[model samples]
Target: MHPLRLLVVTLLIVTVNLLFPGAAHASPAVQYTNPIAAQRADPHIFRHTDGYFYFTATAPEYDRIVLRRATTIQGLATAPETVIWRRHASGEMGAHIWAPEIHFINGKWYVYFAAGRADDVWRIRMYVLESSSANPLTGAWTERGRITTPWDTFSLDATTFAVNGVRYLLWAQQEPGIATNSNLYIARMGANPWTITGATTRLTVPALAWETRGYKVAEGPSVLQRNGRLFLTYSASATDANYCLGLLTAAATANPLQAGSWTKSPNPVFATNATTSQYGPGHNSFTVSEDGQSDLLVYHDRSYRDISGDPLNDPNRRTRVQKVYYRADGTPDFGIPIPDGLTPARLISYDTPGAAVRHWDFRARLETNVTPLADSQFRLVAGLSGSGTVSLESTNYPGYYLRHRNHEAWVQQRDGTTLFNADASFIRRTGLTGSGTISLESANFPGYFLRHRAGQVWVEQNDGSATFRNNASFTLE
Candidate 1:
């Protein structure tokens, strides 16, 4: 070939390499850190078709409805919030604005919230706000008026969902004949969301001992539909440490307005786990992850169990989120609320697809079968600087981190030792698969990579073989 032709080919190759560097290496897995927004309770996050997640929750003051949107769930944490609506100074909707949920329906955005009148603070009722704009965060929200119930009584936590081409509204209210503070009810909604068309049916009351712990309350209902079943989860007890979640299940084809169609779980489905130091883990909403592969539970909880006076006055109930797992029986397994901090994740070995990297007796090893909660979870934190490095902190053992000493990985306690910091941090890199896989290179050892050999983890130099590449790659879940 002529020299001019050779030069042209080399230039083209260089241009292609520069334009698509990722084609030569694996892309980093998408990961998100949680507690998306702090000091915000009753979080309702909905991912719209516009590729943004709109978040709205009850402000701590309980005087206004605030909203924020972001391209990613974690981005909502720092996104500027807009006060869409505020409580009136006197008449109805004058006080106690709570649990505002944003929904897009029939080309309009609707916000359903619970509010009370200034004269009667305890007389809580549900109301709706409508926005015609595509983006709810920037639009003008007009009052759609109150959602009146059959009996004039306390009603709140209004949530709406459509199944089989029919929309239904589910909420908690104080029934006239029932002695309990509130009960779960459902009614078919009319053309407008603020109006209910059919007869209301009481689904569940605070009859169980667990549901009536502090206050005979059954409120804050949220829905999750899967596997031919409709799961309606609601908060029970009081809004303190006794606060928990209860489940009411019905078939997808069953008539939602019929009280006989639903079966209430005898016990609370999700409750406070003292082991995780999370109290009052209730008022949950569900959303799918950005990738559309994982379902997340968005809720609020207090880090501490003790509150100053009334739990209602406590401002520590902050918004949090976690992955929701499903059981083989087609039911949701809302395990315990994980401890607060950064989001916890699992490390899956690429060599053996389903195998996970776990710590047992402070030693890191590849376990084909591992327990879900403690052993396999780690909080991946950015290392010392923004140098594309990371440190793995054990979820169960607070300050302990994954460190390599003498070429083997072990869970070591971080005791302000210089060697510990140097050994614990690993430089994150693209995986061998060239997409959504992660490879950790030892920060201190430079060229060495974290790998599993004979089920034990070790730091070794890459051999550029299929086995070595597979051993070094991991999926951050």
Candidate 2:
């Protein structure tokens, strides 16, 4: 072969390899093994600068600020737990620190959490603690001071977000003028962390049915952004199983400071199990997993049955997580309550195999030169070889993306025939006739196989199944 021919063949082989790197990987939604972690609630998860996940939650029985770090969600549970801050004396700073949040701003680390006087749980106010190191685990935290505002009333659940280089703080409070329960408020940050630039603008009050469930409240705000829109997701209703999630959104072109600028969703975005034992599903924070695929929603919910409707009495509000999704429009559609045993969608990884007929939530890897399909009928391109983890998705399916290995992997399309591509144009559907030679990709491993008649594409050991019909229009598994 000529030198140019050799280069073309080599490039084709590499393109195919990249297209279907993992042909025999796990199903994206395979249930994650539990207990991912134990006894955590009001989870505050943040992806650290160092590519690790840092998590904090409400320590129900203790007065200390707890922190956990891990490379993966499952690893977080086993990662050693650290108590960074504890209550001080008998005064407002001495007791009942709740919903602690850690943030890295400027050149140092700051922890924002609400604490109350030892004797009174209602005196809860948000305070800040500082650390010097970039890596939080190695730093020593110094008490910065209580974040103050214009009002002297009770407040808690303080959170901050920076928009277009402007910093803003939000919290729940009972202003002197408002007679109802705690409402949500937002304000601009001043020169120092302690100062407020202007009067706090009231963002929301109890209006929706979910917001008025137990105490007519709306608090615990966490923000999500997409397509130049800002979404403020907050917990509402009583903390019992009735606890739910609500949204407030505004366009990037709108004034974030104007109270009317943010539009409230008429219905709750996420909620608790009306039939199941899960209760009070609120107080959530969002984070992206290591692979940067989907948004993860981290909140606390009661695993056990709730005898009382009151949010305060429930002791089992443990931390839980589920994948957050978006609708056809830019708005979010936080689907039904995900069960505790439900596994999170897998992040696309290099070693994963991606082949499957269903194309269920698997994604493919893309490079500039890779060609997916010859035509809609499914033809292979000689310039491309199904070499690496093949990332491909079905056109008609929303949640389906599959990656599989090349040699041992097979795909059964809607016609129910085992298939593989040739030259990106022709289709050749084969039959295993039995389950002996199949494998399915998984969250932690490559591929596992079962009965062939079970209707799932299986892979051989260490094989990836991420190939598809068309390269140009295809998405990887």
Candidate 3:
């Protein structure tokens, strides 16, 4: 290329970036710290058309419905919350105000939540509150009264979504004849947004042994439509360490009103990951990022395992969020609950294409179908050695960092030694093979680069091999 043409192209790129922010650097919404809001359980976040994310959840006090708004998902962590509605002194909606989901439907905002009577606190029922104001924080919330189900039994966790231009309501309720505590049901909400006007279909029951731990239950339904299918997820079992998420999938072209159309996964998709120290991770809601490209999983989980007395009394079930990844077959691979702290990213190998840098038996390697997905996630943070470089920290194991021991790249715990620091630190360089890729050059070993050989990752100086450039470079996904 000519010198003048190269200079003109560089100037054009800079001008375009200056005129439009994020025009050159398009980073998706994948980086967000965990425990987004402390003590906010059964979290539900909705990204509305107003370019604001609306968040609501079960307050620790279990006595009021609250809402908050922010432009970015991470901004909601410190956003001021407003008490939209409180529990009644007595009678209907008197206590146990839980799992409030805010949604904008047909130009009106509606909040769906559960409450119990003051006289009998266990008399849990579903209810709705509506608002006409553009901003939900300033509107008058008119009570829409109780949503009458098939039986006047235990019911809660009501969620609503539209499928193929038709709206439907999904919730958990106890069937009159069923022995389980509650079962999931769904029906169409035709003209009225608050009423179920069509045939009610039973989606799941507590038939599996895992679903009957502390109590036989299945609740908290959330749906995501993608890849020509409607993927529905729900919480199951007791709200203890046994609490987990189960999946049910149905084709988008099939009738959602029929029980035969949906197929439920035999096992739990997302559950308690003791390794990550997240327990009873359940009752999740799905939302997209500001770019509307990445799907974010918003749920609640406790950092500890032990809960004295009833799990309901525990106040440490904090709200959290993480990006959901997809498999080659177009299905979601939820993996497990990511440990606390920095948001992690996958290191996709440029040479192997789809294979990612993952840890196996404490050693780093580039591989596909990595189990417990956190093994493939690494947080590139400010260098433990110094600020001039970066250190790759393991997501599942918080204190551990990826460092070279005898030229072998391994995910090991930080030893607080100068040698460990220098070995772990690397200078992120532009891709040696192509654009949009990165090569990590060892800070201590100078010319040596982090490369993959025979599937294993190692910090080795270039051997003048044909695959040297391709092996050392990777694309962060």
Regions of model 1 farther than 4 Å from truth: 1-30, 207-210, 249-270, 273-277, 326-335, 339-341, 360-370, 384-388, 404-412, 443-449, 452-465
Local error of candidate 1 at residue 162 (angstroms): 1.2
Per-model lDDT: 0.84, 0.61, 0.89
TM-score, candidate number 1: 0.82
Using all chains and alpha carbons, the TM-scores for the candidates as numbered come to 0.82, 0.69, 0.92
* Per-residue accuracy of model 3 over 291-380 as CA lDDT, tens digit each: 887888899999999989999998989999988888778888888898887778887776676678889989999897777788998888
Cα lDDT tens digits, model 1, 1-477, are 999999998886566346534332322233556566778888899999999999999898999999999988888989999999999999899999999999998999999999999988888999999999977778898999999889889999999999999999999999888899999888999878889997888888898888998899999998899999899999999889999999999999998888888899988878887867889989989998888767788899888888888888887788888876554477886767777767777777765655668899999999854654467778888774236789998876778889998999999888777778888989989886445678899888888999999999998998898679878988776
The full ranking of all candidates by TM-score, starting with the best, is 3, 1, 2
Order of quality (lDDT): 3, 1, 2
Model 2 residue-pair collision total: 95
- TM-score winner between candidates 1 and 2: 1
List the RMSD of every prediction in angstroms. 6.1, 10.6, 4.3
Off by over 4 Å in 2: 1-35, 274-277, 308-310, 344-477
- In model 3, the runs with Cα more than 4 Å from the true position are 3-29, 433-435, 462-467
Candidate 3 TM-score over all chains jointly: 0.92
